[model samples]
Target: AQSVTQPDIHITVSEGASLELRCNYSYGATPYLFWYVQSPGQGLQLLLKYFSGDTLVQGIKGFEAEFKRSQSSFNLRKPSVHWSDAAEYFCALRRDYKLSFGAGTTVTVRA
Candidate 1:
């Protein structure tokens, strides 16, 4: 069974500040990893994925993530986040539509 868990239900970041979103998974084998961002009540946008190879993967909207085998975690990071980046960020596993999602972390960007 493959699954993802986001501990933080919501996060608040000042404009131009750094942001980190945590994600942990349970899988038999290394499964396709993904970070997606969706505006309120909108579709998801692919941030990045680590199917294999480099554990450190880069993604869209200046987002990146690292795959840690030991902890079974893949965390998302951004150097400086803008208010426009404010959205509902979801961490999803790539094992068919049966994707297990976190309760979604709503990012509040303070201007």
Candidate 2:
């Protein structure tokens, strides 16, 4: 089966603390890896993506991710998180013209 899975359904971190969201997938080939963040009742925002070349990619809202081809994973990380960062994170892969998304991991930042 080719799918993306997020181990944690939810995560809570203190404001100003570091955060990491795990994403694992099973695919025949390296599909286009992407991380998107969605605010409450809002559409998903592109955080980062792994197409080719570099395995590490940076994105807006102070987020970054490293693609590990051997492990079949692409994890999102932020050194310091703010309250506004509290949102849902989704790992996705381009499957044909469609995309497969993980169930999503909700992030809660405590102040």
Candidate 3:
């Protein structure tokens, strides 16, 4: 079984500042990892994904994540955050055609 853990339940970031969200996964083998963001009253949007090859993967909205096998982590980061970036972020692990998600981290952007 695979599970994901998002250490931060809530995060507050200043507008135009950098932001990082921690995500750790527990699985036997390397599993497909994904980061999804959901704005208020909106559906989940794919931020980035890491399956194989590159250790660092970039996605839409200037977001990127690095897959570290040693740390069992796939943390997401954005160089500069915008007010619209405020949303709930989820870390998911896919295996056997099933997806397991983390508890989620809610990001609040302030000016």
User: TM-scores across all candidates?
Assistant: 0.92, 0.96, 0.97
Q: Extract clashing residue pairs from model 1.
A: none
Which lDDT value does model 1 have at 45? 87
Residue-level lDDT of model 1, residues 1-111, one tens digit each, is: 437889999899999999999999888777788888998778888889889999999998899999999998999999999988999988887776566776678899998
Tell me, by lDDT, which candidate is best.
3
Q: So what's the TM-score on candidate 2? A: 0.96
Ranking by lDDT: 3, 2, 1
Decreasing TM-score order of the candidates: 3, 2, 1
* Candidate 3 structure quality by residue, lDDT tens digits, 15-92: 999999999999989779999999999999999899899999999999999999999999999999999999999999
Full-model lDDT for every candidate: 0.87, 0.93, 0.95
- Ten consecutive residues with minimal summed lDDT in candidate 1? 94-103
- Which lDDT tens digits does candidate 2 get at residues 20-51? 99999888876798999999999999998988
Task: Mark the regions of model 1 whose C-alpha exceeds 4 Å error after superposition.
Answer: none
- Single out the weakest 10-residue window by summed lDDT for candidate 3: 1-10
